[model samples]
Target: MRFMWLPIVESVRMYLQSLPEIAETYEVDLIGNLPKGGGSSIEIDWEAERGAAETVNTTGAVAVHLLIKHRTDDTDIWRAFREQYRIQNLILQEIRRLHDYILTNLKIAVKISATGVEPLGDMVRPYYGNELILVFEWKGAIRDGRYES
Candidate 1:
């Protein structure tokens, strides 16, 4: 049995990179976490933990953290606020799109549990970031003392 998370992250990265608006508007980067940088970028981190297998059922969770950071050289408050809202909208759209696709496409009996989005903070100059969290739980049959879902 295999439980690879990178494939899911890669899938998301590819989808985001293919979006015309995101491709032309932002530099979407997929990594374990956010690094020090500026401009517009995105980072998606996959986290998961295995659960004990019962007599006939196996379960676990898959979570992903999607972080989006948008920065600008301009320090004007109004402009910065405008940019923030614009980037926020774009990120939200992408998150919704990704979630819907995954919920419908993944073959396994995985279920999306909770999702949330929040502003990272207001520290960096002319920069705004939002964090999106997605959790998926899988409950499936055990096979040969192993879980494959």
Candidate 2:
């Protein structure tokens, strides 16, 4: 059985990279994984949860965590907050596009389960960001001793 995490994550990264607002504005890697060190950038993290399985098929869910981070030296806290909000909205706009893309292209069903915003750094560090959680459910069929999406 081939796990779907790698393909799904790669597809998401590619889709996000196609967006100029994300690719041009932030420092995204070729594969969209988090960089070695933290800076102003966008990254992705994911986990898979297996569900009930039958003899011929199985069900599961994958949670993709979209992290958007921005750092500024400006002392104006409001400006930092505003920038983060703007970035968040930019990401939100692409979510629908991504959902449809996954369904149409990857043939997988995805859902936006939840979203969250929180401070990344304290008064000393100047980092601001939020984490958007997207949960995607998938079904796989077992054929010839192998699994197919």
Report the number of the highest-lDDT candidate.
Answer: 2
* Candidate 1 per-residue lDDT over residues 59-126, each given as its tens digit: 56767776766677776767766665665566556565665664455434555544777778764765
Q: lDDT of all predictions, in order shown? A: 0.63, 0.67
Q: What is the TM-score of each candidate against the true structure?
A: 0.64, 0.73
Predicted candidate 2 versus true structure: per-residue lDDT over 1-149, tens digit per residue: 34566667777787778889777767754325566445677677887565644455555677777776777777887887788788777767767887778666665556655556555543233666666666777677655554467
Please list the residue runs of candidate 2 whose C-alpha ends up more than 4 Å from where it truly belongs after superposition.
30-39, 52-55, 121-124, 139-149
Backbone clash total, candidate 1? 0
Model 2: lDDT equals: 0.67
- Among the numbered candidates, top TM-score falls to 2
Clash pairs (backbone) in predicted model 2:
none
